[model samples]
Target: MLLMGVERFPTTADPHGEPAPGHTDWPRLPFVPGLMSRLDLAYKRVGYEVLSVAEPDRRAVMLHSDAAVHSSTTRIVHALSHGTPAADLSRSPAAAGQEHVHMVPACATLGTGTDVSQWVRIAHQQAQPTLFVIDLCRAGRSARLSELTRVPDGELNAWVIAATSPDRPAYDGRFSEAVAEVLEQIADHGLDTSPSIRFVRWDRVTRAIQNSLEGLGSSQRIHTTRVDVSQELPELPFFPNPRWRPGTRLEKLHDVVPPVRAFVADLGAEHFMDRVDDHFVGRQSQLHWLAAWLDDDRVGGLRVVTGAPGSGKSALLGALVCSGHEAVIDAAPDIRAYLSAQSPEGVCSPNPLLAAIHSRGRDIDAVMTSIALQWRLPSEPERRWSVADLISEAGTLPAVPALVFDALDEAEDPDDLMKSLLIPLAGAVRPDGRSLVRLLVGTRRWPAGPLLTLAGRDGGLLDLDDVPVEEIRSDLRSHMLRRLSSLPQYIPPEQRPIRTALAETVAEALTEETDRMHEWGPFLVARIFGHVLATQPVPDNVDAAVARGRTVPRSLPDVLELDLDRRPDGKDLRAVLAAVAFAKGDGFPTEAVAAVAPEFAPTPNVAAGCSLARATDQDLLQHVRGLLDAGSFYLRTGVETDGSTLYRLFHQGLADYLQAHPYPLDSATRSEAI
Candidate 1:
């Protein structure tokens, strides 16, 4: 880690000893020294080697003057852009290795000694996973440096966090102080008690800093760039949780099984949904019904939320978990009084046990083990716990425990999961004729077994298909507007108005198309058309953009098929998607994708007018990277062990589509791909 603090800058002279124009001698922020000290101690406590180049450290290169600061900044950029040699490492604290963090707390202005352009230029040639925490005025503008340099997003490997937006000024010392406070809090008190999450992610850290700044009465908003690509920076041991023990009873559950990280990172889950929490609108009636059901002491069986493909079932469940039951009621004042009257104590458990079946699918054993661990059931080495054991354990707790499971149809054996775990847990009853546990499940279709019988008897099913057409349309439009505004391409304040108008126009067109065609729903329309509109150039007239939006296909599969047929590299893209869909375990690594894509490539022939050349390994890799950078609707990304990229289909729906309409390949080519 490299820490640089500049509280003051020279006004009269530049680094070259020339007369500096439009440069002001920034006032010294006394709190900077203390902030750096706190950070140094906090990082050391969390087992990071502390390297400081800030104030009052005479042994290291000091930022005492403009020339020194400028020279140091240039050297740091050189080390990051090029390879760091022994000389560079010895002269400066910045290291050119993977997972290095560079933090600067200074007054940055254009044409000043502390200008950040040189630091931002490092993104042009960054080859490792690097993080930059810029605490200065207009720090967020550093992200635009890539645009100015014409560097593509996939080529850049740097993650940035700025104290304020591009057109705003930051309150001196507040951002740095917030960072120190958050790091200290994580080091002293762990971020979460769940053993499934072993580290405090960078996204969580940014939220904590924002909350701290808000408490200090600062209106400045922090901006982050390339967040999705490097959101797992903390998993690089950026900040290890002090409370995570390796051999605890809960930890043993994940010993042979894969970690639930993929489910946690799902687009509909808490981590990703939290980014768009404000955009979540509508679903009040559904939420109200769920709230009433959760609070009712008379009910304890399963409450399945069923919907067709592209329906917003996942989003609704995700919102419920992100915002607790009370927040839901508080958002709807009319329903709050009635809900409070029904349950005076409260509507639901404060923190429910939440889990989603992995997209690749989890077995019955893994499913039961996860539930048992979350309930804090004691692990017995000699005996394996069953569904009955979990039910009995829940009855002993002071309050009833709620178990929320999503994507039940995505399980390895849906029938086994329904029969072995969910069915029994739903029917478990206490001695007083009350339900032992509260169960909620989300699935694309109803299971064909005893689970259906339970739902029929209890009347606990909430079918999203039954939602009014107008309500669904309104909710989807709201979702599209929110999604458009949050795209990284249009995040700057200057681009907001144009994107807003375009979002409104596009949302209207897509919602109208959905009305004409009954199959399309919220998930498909928002994802498909949102990506389509975001990638297109902004029109000079909002009215003109509406015409362009009307040109989109009427159905999800048609849009996907159109994309496959139109692109120049369509065949190669399909090959990569197939590889990801058929991949075992988590997903396919970039190296594996590159190796397998060529086998599925088209054969050269003159009769069919096949003019495209065979792609090399480098070409294949670059193609995949470009797709990810362009925000392909079909692909999702993960990090490999060496910090490279991994690729997977965005959801099971896409995989299903690909399976139904597979690309043809010759027998020899198909065998090689297999």
Candidate 2:
């Protein structure tokens, strides 16, 4: 891309035009050529395709410079744009539009020893580049009074007027010195990963840097702002909504059709589709309470909305977003405008969450930016403001809307999150001396104390137990009905009622002795239903089954016992069955089996103790044929106790039944078992 600079005059000695080599004082330029060269080189070095253009309208053409090329300009541009020092220069512009062309004459007066505003005017006029106005007066101390470490200065600028004055050393003297020092530091150290710079005083842009650097660097990001540190900033209302509506620019964009669909596809409609809840029923009363909390014309703070697991917290949050709150919907446009003003990039940051905040609009972006900045994610540039800084700076932002953070537990660190985020945000007073924000957080039980404290301190805590049971019931019934109705020849739409009844019956039966069935949530209810159907006889046994279903044993042994009692073969197979039962879980641990009923250990045929030997004589083998065919037991390999292995009851109920009811022994020696 071509990196073109639109200027009234040309610095290059054009091959096709007159060279003004002798017309200017080159020595007094303060290495002006070097500065410009540095910017060009640095931008190119960072992989930005660079090109120089005196007249952009003309196809970018190269001209050999009559004067020596200085690297200062390239380095300065690179530092300002990417927070990186100059490295290398690209031979040519890589592509066209990707080039970040810096407009010249930004501080021509500074280097030429002249006025400052002239450069600002020139820089401001250039539409293609981001404006950078430097003041050489900020070379040493800053306007604001603050302690700072020494650093080199990188940027060069002219001063039309004194940035500092005697009446306020805070604004002028020390401030300018501080600013200059910071620039010098940037020049010397290059850009470190940590953008930890902060500004304590607005007018002391120079000095504030000194004050802020006393802190440590952040591992995440850096935040900077246009907020005045010395004076209190006016609280700005949150920005208006950014949602596209009729006759709006977004509407026009959407009207184009293809792109709008593409945009929706990009937003991952499918991802949230299953999780989205449209009408989260049973929370109407709670909704009203939340609305009232938001309307407090008094001090603005935050509210904690909590519930048990599966209490539909996510659903409710979705519903709130759709329904539009007094603070959010009404003021969306204003918030959008504010965000647009702050970040023209439209929030497409590399960070997914940050990107979401950016694209949605400014009010959200501002809040997210503040959070990210506090984490040292570089809200603006090289450094981030602290929590105190954010609270102070929030004044400049648009309406601080009622912020909502759902699924608090899902955050990386809930404890740190509560203390750092919720605490300050909850206590944040408005610019007008009232609370600026009304924050809302949704989390499950096992409540964090900090969260509770926040709730106790001026904010209301509304338990979600009151969430309607009907909603859960509705969700379950709908799911079951949909599944049943899908059968072609079976379970017609009319039969959906029967399915629902069956589901409800099963649910009630399982949870009747427990708690409210709906309170168990859909997942747990489904598990209970699965147990009922797995062992219950289907279709033919429907009626007797419904009544006896509750009687259904809760484990495998119970099922086996019931099956054995109803069948004739089980009686004849008494000895084998008894022996199998005795050797229950994990093959009944051979030694323990010998102690309990040891006659079986010596021989398969047992006449003593539990009547195993006698039962074996009565065609027990004949009776056991069915069970053997059914894969219940296999022959004992190796020793009767050692390698013993066979099918045992799989469920707890079966093992419990067999263990609880021990067969009576007939002989004393046999009864003693081994």
Candidate 3:
């Protein structure tokens, strides 16, 4: 097969005219050069035939740069082919420009911004590249700040991504920091890894970058478009003759992390999980109320415990989960509980709870499993587990099961969740007229929101405001002392007496100041401790610093910013913090942060005097100790009870702060590594 390739460039200095020594468009073709590098390695790894088109002495207008010497045809075949999709690889140009294509300046400035038709025309001209990926974007006006995080379209299959919406200024090469990051990620790990026929899943790389860009705030959204291929391309692991096998029915649960995390992230803890330094105080009445719901003959009604953070509503719910309310223990000892630990606020469809997998990460597979397995009923996957199916599964069980959802107001769409999950479950009845399941919901009391009517309807209301100011003070004091214990270890043993005395003074001062604020949630108190630990040694004038309220935040968002300010890893820590903050309920994996900036994972922890790149899990944990505690701004979503965890902004305050102030990510900060 004779293959002839032509690229028109103003400069051709390095013999083959590759990333021409001084060519203007050199950097824009990063992937072009990158793939060439992979092709050379592909040859070494798979031993593909390397044919030289050049007749050495004859020169023969041949491609000769280190990476450019090899054939792209072979690289695309092994590194980019998806099954037997038919198309050849080639390039052409049309629609030289469009309105404000700010994504990749290096490419757009040259003559890139083109419509799908132009690309299709070009594809037809080239005989069609087997896997043609046209990286393009047309910036669009981002609406009011209120609708910032909303993606314009939900169904995306095209290859185009909006790196920068129209409102942003045009960049030099159309190459977003996001594109560079993913391309490098793909290169680091070979594009195609088929045991049999080697075919690259090009769509996965684009999709990964698209998803990552959303974390950059609403200004950058992504979409995909078809170029010219007509084959019904198969989904993901894009290899020819894809291999697979089925295992035991239960074995299929391995891939349910995102959904379960979403489910739990939206679900409230049974009550509250207290950090060693944090304590859950008061709300005994609320706990009893939750227990009564489980055992009461009248089933399926909302048992709401409402309060601001730190008010113990969540703790009351948590306690019930751990040790069912005492009222029910004597009457209904066999009752079981299913919990939703995170908020389900922003979801458009309640179907996330109905299916095992949801693209948006709102699946409830884990909860169903618990309910099914606990009752010894057939709990098929979420897709097949309808409301009727649940009732059928529970029909034979002697003990009635209870469902508790916490943090209703925090849900992306509390009103939607209430209508979809709460009311439906509440209304689900048996032949005896009693609802099939007991229900408990905990949320904030909104002054004027959709949940008021639902919150008021016949169910019991446990308000934290009635819990007395003195009880909160006692809880705050207890919390302060526990935080102080962690600080003595940070101080040198020789100076213990002075430091301990000073730290206690500071903690006492903080508690008093905290009691004055609104319910001083566990999170704010934790930061106060973080501040004390950070600026330790009980300065020569400790009494003065304590009295001055040196580090306490005026508001919750301020607390997050302050905590971020105290992070030990400098820029690296700041960048990762921003990502976790934006991740919200859908927490990220350890490697996810690494994808944004290769240097982040490898960056040195100058404060701890070690490189994070080589740090052990314990080292990583130690480095992020500030974020691990209860009420801390970030939470790590890990496999069941395992010390290992991936991070997300657990505190709503952090998410609110980031939405208001997308720092370390605004145009200026983005110029850096993140």
Top candidate (lDDT): 1
Candidate 3 local lDDT, residue 396: 47
- The residue-by-residue lDDT of candidate 1 on 478-528, one tens digit each, is 666677667776676766666666655555665565443445554565566
Candidate 3: tens digits of C-alpha lDDT, residues 588-613: 54445444322334345466543544
Query: In candidate 1, how many Å is residue 190 off?
Result: 28
What is the C-alpha local distance difference test score of each model? 0.55, 0.35, 0.40
lDDT for model 3 comes to 0.40
Where in model 1 is the C-alpha error above 4 Å?
A: 1-263, 268-281, 295-299, 324-349, 352-360, 381-383, 446-450, 487-520, 540-542, 563-568, 604-633, 638-646, 664-674
TM-score of each: 0.53, 0.32, 0.45
- TM-score of candidate 2 to 2 decimals: 0.32
Give candidate 3's error at residue 437 in angstroms: 2.6
Candidate 3 TM-score over all chains jointly: 0.45
Clashes of each: 0, 83, 40
